[model samples]
Target: MYNLVRFLQKHHFFILFVFLEVLALSMLSRSHHYQRASINHRTNNLAASIYHLQSHISDYFSLRYQNTILQKQNAELLHKLALAHLPEPQPDSILKERLVDYIPARVINNTVNLRNNYIIINKGYRDGVARDMGLISADGVAGIIIGVSEHYATAMSLLHQHSVLSIRFLKNDQIANLHWRGGNYRQAEVVDIPSHVIPQQGDSLVTSGHSFVFPEGIMVGTVDEVMESEKGNLNSARVRFSTDFGKLRYVYVVKNVYQNELDGLAKIKTNE
Candidate 1:
């Protein structure tokens, strides 16, 4: 109590001055329109700044939600595109059968330099991803799912030595098999384009839809160069891949709904 009294005595004048200054300012603000307006203006500005900061924080946290929604929307659009790209002579009922569905997934692991490069994605059989399901990027054809676990899957990249994808000339519809020869990630060779139908440089190649894997017209790449085959009957052309394997981040696994039926028919025909 004694220390408190001494401390008050030492700063009593300063305390009194501060108290009076506050009281005077309060009275001035109440009595003068300009002072009141100035105070209100400052308060409003502070509130606005606080609200803006809160808004930015909210938006930042919602980015993941927005991205997920966008992925779903893109999947729906790609599914429709795949069905529409199906070859003609089909009834509307068959077309509506939804031969293909798209499941969006992120690439958790990938490689481009290896002789047999593979991609790992954050999806599996439980997520509707299965072996032989076709994979594609936003830009073009990517790979095919070769192995699947409950929550993860492996894709054989186009750069793999054993990778084979059926592709067709966009202009003439001439079909050929695309294979990787190793060494280059951007380039693959089309095995059997007839020598007479020369594929000019920059000619686009797309999926032939015969594989029952990738839907027809999904871009593979453009012809970078054409070379004579040692067999002399066919010409092989180097295709520059549309999808950059090194930069693959997201992909869609395509499920061909009618593939089983088609495969069963083929098996029966073979037996006959």
Candidate 2:
């Protein structure tokens, strides 16, 4: 009680001045219409600003949830598109079977500088993802799944040295093999192109759909430069990859519904 008394005595003049200032402002606002209106307008604006800031903070925190929902929607749309591309059923045959399915995944880890680049995703065997499944980004092809655990999967990125993708030219449908040489992550080379087929710059390349991994017409890259083979029998071209591996975040795993049937036929042919 003694300390409180001393403190109040020391600051009494300053405290009185602050109290008087507030009292004077209240009286002015109450007596003058212009002052009251101005004060109310300022208070409303401050409240609005506070509310807007709170709303932005909330949206920032909920971005991951929104992204997950969007990913699922995109996967469903891709599945529908695949079904729509299927051939019409014959009069005697029913078209009740689906050809492929897309599983949305988030890329948790990725590398682009290494000779053997790899991508790690949040989905695995439990999520219906499996080895040899094709991985693609929103823009284009990203990688192929090489291993899977219960809750995670690893993929061999298209930028790897040993990576090879079957690609077809959009102009003439000439098939070629896309290979990486361990340099630029954004560039690759398409080889085994026929000598007679000339690929110009800006030519689009897409998946050939020869294997059960990726579906047909998934974009791969664009021709950057043409390099004719020294032997003159085959040609190759530099390609700019459509998917930027350094910025990869979300991807889709392609699951071929008829993989077992295709694998059985492939094994039979191998035995022959």
Candidate 3:
């Protein structure tokens, strides 16, 4: 207290000068039109800058909420799209209802730099997520569920060496198997496309609906390059995966309604 008093006494003259200067400015601003206008403009600018800073901070924190909302919206759109693309009812056949259902999930854990990459989602049997369920992102097919807990599930990512998905050429409907080479996260190899199929660069491919994991016509990727096998009977393609694994935040797990019936028949055939 004593030091503060002495310091103030020593600078009293300078302090008084500053105080009078501020008082004069205040009076001038109130009395003169131009000074008042300038002061108002400065005040308005300061308020606007503070508001902008507040808004920016709010948006930064709300990003996760916004992403979750987008994921749910995408799940709804995917459900509708799957139903719309169902094959037209045959002339004498009854159309099946509810062929597919989508469960929205957030990716809680993921890795791309592994020999067999896996994705862990915040959904499990409790959320109707199960093994063999297909996972997809907003852009394309993401993975297939391989393990499930009560409240979480693990999926085999498209980047996994053992991950294989049956895909078909969008142009010619030629079927092939997609497998990853385990180095580049963005590229996969398409095998079993016969040489006679003639795939070009940028040819689009989609799920074939053979395994019932994914709906037919879900995009896989585009052909980046093609090479003829040494045997000259088959062609392989380097597919640029549509789903960016590094940026995956949310995914949809697709459950096929008729999967049980299909699995029963397959088990019987295997036993026989």
Candidate 4:
């Protein structure tokens, strides 16, 4: 009690000044219409700012959950897409089973500036991801899984020198091979194009689906420049890749249901 009294006595004048200031403000606001309106407006604005900050904080915290949901939804949608299924033998025949299944994965490590770049994803053999499975980004084709462990997988990015994809021109169905050379990661080269097929700038390309690694019609890129072989027998073009390797964050691993059977048949043919 003695300490409390001494503390109060020491700060009594300051406390009284604060109390008087508050009292004066209350009286002025209550008596004058302009003061009351101004105070209310300021209070409302402060409250609004607090609420806005709270909302943004909530959204930032929930972003990862939202992204996971979106990835699952996209995988489901990809499974249902007709391009992921084998074509029906008859025009009116019932649709065949889906040829491709997509498993959502997050890229944990990536590179874009190397001659032989590789990508490491969070999914692995435990998640049904395996060697030779195709990898694709939201925008387009990304790479192919080359190695897998129980909990992680590594892929050769499409930007690698050894990475090659069988691609087709969307406009004319011209098949070509896409490969990346050192330098710009945004671009690759398409070769083995037949001379008869003339490629123009901005012409779109997609997966050929012959290897069964990726589904047909998945976007690859667009022609940025047309080039002719020195021998003039084959044409080539520079392609502006659809998937920006530097920005790769999430990708889908493609699983072909008939891959084993197809491999068996291919092996038999090779023996013959």
**Model 4, CA-based lDDT:** 0.79
Error of 3 at 24 (Å): 83
- The candidate with the higher lDDT, 1 or 2, is 2
Instruction: For candidate 2, list the clashing residue pairs, or say none.
Output: none
Error in Å for residue 212 of model 1: 0.7
lDDT of 2 by residue, 216-266 (tens): 999999999999888889888999998878777768999999899999999
Tell me which residue pairs clash in candidate 3: none
lDDT of 1 by residue, 1-272 (tens): 99999999999999999999999998756634322322332112333344445544555655675577558658988999899788878567755666688899877667898887777777777898877789998778999877776677777778876677889999999989999898878888886889888889999999999989898899899999999777679998989998877666668999998878988998999999
Sorted on TM-score, best first, the list reads: 3, 4, 2, 1
Pairs that clash in candidate 4: none
Please provide, for model 3 over 1-272, each residue's C-alpha lDDT reduced to its tens digit, 9 standing for 90 to 100: 99999999999999999999999989756634322332332212333344445544555655786587577667988999999787766643435466899898877667899877777776778989877789998779999887676666777788865577899999999999999988899999987889888799999999999988899999899999988788888889999998888777667999998889989999999999
Q: Which stretches of candidate 4 lie over 4 Å from their true place?
A: 1-94, 229-231
TM-score of 4: 0.67
Candidate 1: how many backbone clashes? Answer: 0
